[model samples]
Target: MTAIVVAGGGLAGAAAAAALARAGRDVTVLERDAAPAHKICGEFLSVEAQASLAAIGFDAAVLGGHRISRLRLVRDDAAVSVGLPFEGLGITRRRLDAALLDHAASCGAVVRRGVAIRGVDCSDGLRLDLAGEAPIRPDMLLLATGKHDLRGVRRQAAEPEALVGFKMYFQLNPAARQALAGHIDLILFDDGYAGLQMVEDGMANLSLLVDRARLQRVGGTWTALLADLVKRNTLLADRLIGSVPLLEQPLTIFRVPYGFVHRPTANDPDRIYRLGDQAGVIPSFTGDGMAIALHSATRAANAIIAGHTASAYHRALRRDISGQIRRAAALYRLARMPLAQRALFGVAGTFPSLLRLAAQYTRVPPRARSALY
Candidate 1:
């Protein structure tokens, strides 16, 4: 049996594998996709995420990420702009995931690309069934699939409502690029919010989180929904009127439980550590999902290596981010209402420190300097 097996090669899984391998523990990562690609996310990495990446020996600048220093909130013609509490980066998942996975391999973690974990048999230890190979049981398993559920060990959440997220890359013209440079713009409308920021190669990443019912009302097609949004949101129309899509179709995901928090019960499975979105999903607008993933990976890897149970790991993770998750959820709800959104922009404009406080509160507390390494 292998010492450890990790499912999903996204930020959480790769970070875990790299940490464990660097500590001289045998680790293997199973990735479904043949190559790294874009995912449905805001793609705005917060300052905490930057620090987490540095702790793992990965540099965002090396990945060609664009710097971000301001936050712009817009609704109709009224807008509010404020300097970020800390630095941030706008990066594409394609570049970020590839760099972390390559770093995992360099740290002696066996990264098996093009391998999909069909299911897991946890009767005795953890047995992972690969697509075209015999089932192998590992001493421990870490689930970090990031919003994609795996069979036989799918995560359960208590949240009843969910949001659908759509993301697309665009080639912005000089005017749009200049307008969006060094800033992350968030446009709020009825029942949804959209984010635009410049990423690597001077490309822009536009991501939206909308109520599922709202999306269905706009004809259920990405183009239709986006077109409708442009009509409804004047700021989005101004920024993206002439932008060109890089792909034939925008990447989309459904049923994203925005405020999910996983709690382990007495009957939960053993020897399986849940990381990233599998553990808990903070609101995307907070831009702390990536930080949570990296921090969870580092903490869980350390806990497991020091002889801790998966249940303990889950409880600790819940305790760590409970406050941040609640705050982000409240902010998400407030943004969904047009009146509340307008009020928020007004308040943020008047009291800029409130935005800084919100940013500070939403950050996942950094691990101890000695404990992190």
Candidate 2:
């Protein structure tokens, strides 16, 4: 049996593997994808996220992250621009994931790419049935599969009307890129929202989240949905008019449990650790998902190194971010309502600092940020 097995080599798994292997533990990561590719994300790296990655010896700036220092919120002809408390980065998940996995490999963790776990059985201990290779019975299994569930190892059900995500890269016309420079565009509609920003290579990422009913109403096609949105939302239409979509279809993920936070339950395996999206999922509107994924993995790794139980680690994670998650969820719900959005926009237009405050409160507490290492 391997000493430790990490499932899903995205942000969480790679970070955990690096931390564990750097500490001299035998760790192996099983990744489904043969290589790091585009992921459905807003691609906004908050200040806290940069700090966490730097603490672990990964520098996103060195990876050519685009600068983001402002927030532009729009609601159909009404828009508010505010300075961010700290400048963040706009980088694609593909670059970030590859760098972290390479770091893990350099730290002596074996990364097995093109490998997918068929199922997880923790009946006696932790056993993973792989697609091609023989099953692995590890001393500990760290679940970091980020929004996707493994067979036989179930996660808590998502909230009703769970959000589905779609992301497409576009080469924006010069005017549009210049207009979006240094700012993250957050365009809100009735049942969904979209985040637009410039990433590396002069490409713009347009990521969207809409509920199931909204998708069905559009005949379950992103193109049709986007066309309908353009007809209604002049703001979105203006930004996308001259942009050339780079993908045949947007990368998509369904039933995203936006407000999920995993707690230690009675049936959870004692030696199984849940990291990243397996641990919690903050609202995407908060722009802290990537940071939470990185920090939670590091935190869980520390817990395991200290001989702590999975339950203890989960409890600590809950303590750290549960309040923030709840606050984010409330704001997300409010932002979806037209009346609440008008009130929010009015208040934000009057007191722009509230926008920064909303960003602050929906993240890992400030008190805990400095101690992440």
Candidate 3:
């Protein structure tokens, strides 16, 4: 049996491994982290994302531990709540990663936890250097490394520089929890936005997405930036003023670029495929990153199953996500413009239902609704 090696056993990697295993491919997944950890993610899965997972046979039990419901958008001091045309799920990355990894393993993929991939050499096949061991070569390579800059991968020069994001978990009061339950509150300001929600364990997830420039202006420390951000936004300040942080430290990452590869084929003779953030990123505003990754993984697996060439697979993946990417890019551009941002809030304040209408495209699935409610 031909074997495929997946680097980075996060959402994309685990999903890709599961898809491959389902297709009868022998798969190995390498993850740097051990079981059960949180990622600096929004933790709120949209309805569409949940639907995608359900289609892949993801277990509903994975989402059983949290609240589920529609999202509430807040702008200009006005809040608009809408039922996700579907439903959204909220689970900590700690729970989510473990569940995904377990699912991958159950599907017959070999998962190597605490194994970091040091390098990738794509020649006839792909050679992966593990931390202190001889390199292992596999028949095919899937780079789901996600957001970590690889030495040899070529990136588009025109792509916007990736922004930095920081998130920390917190235990909230019943009132605070109720305020956050079933709603992903997006607090928008100039240069960045913060998403607030309740996840598993009665904890609230506070995640911020900001440009590198703005982050630097705040001295590049989560403490400094978060303090300044709270001061600037009264809603956040009111909610978190005396709240204790659950994370020992805030999670941060930089330069997360989002775009499609004009060409997906590995031009470097590695025949290696990039998945998720490794492939390309979508803006977090849409909250579709994981969905895009899972969707792309399925597409890639199907292409390989049909014996399609790497280039052909790339084309198929591009075709699938390009439209959404284009729309996201346009929205990003608008968000960056001061007048547009103000105008957006103004309109949102006037027509609260608009936010709900916009969220329809981003709802989660029925099976995972408990987490978000």
**Which residue pairs in candidate 2 have backbone atoms (N, alpha carbon, C) closer than 3 angstroms, thus clashing?**
none
Q: What is the lDDT of residue 100 in candidate 1?
A: 94
Residue-level lDDT of model 1, residues 245-352, one tens digit each, is 997888887777778888889977878999999998888888999988988898888888788888988888888877788899898888787789878878987997
For all candidates in order, the CA lDDT equals: 0.85, 0.87, 0.72
Tens-place lDDT digits, model 3, residues 48-111: 5565567567864466655556666654455656665555677877787788889999998999
Q: Judged by lDDT, which candidate is best?
A: 2
Better of 1 and 3 by lDDT: 1
Using Cα atoms with residue i matched to residue i, what is each candidate's TM-score against the true structure? 0.95, 0.96, 0.89
What local lDDT score does residue 87 receive in model 1, on the 0 to 100 scale? Answer: 84
RMSD score of candidate 2 (Å): 1.5
- Over the stretch 1-373, how does candidate 2's per-residue lDDT look in tens digits? 3499999999889988998988999999999999888898999998888888787677889999789999999877888999988888999999989998999999999998999999998787778999988988999999999888899877785653556789999998888899899999998887888999999999999999887788889888998889988898877787888889998889998767767888788888888888888888888988898888888888888988889898988998888888898999899989877789788888998999999999889988876665556
lDDT ranking of the models: 2, 1, 3
TM-score of 3: 0.89
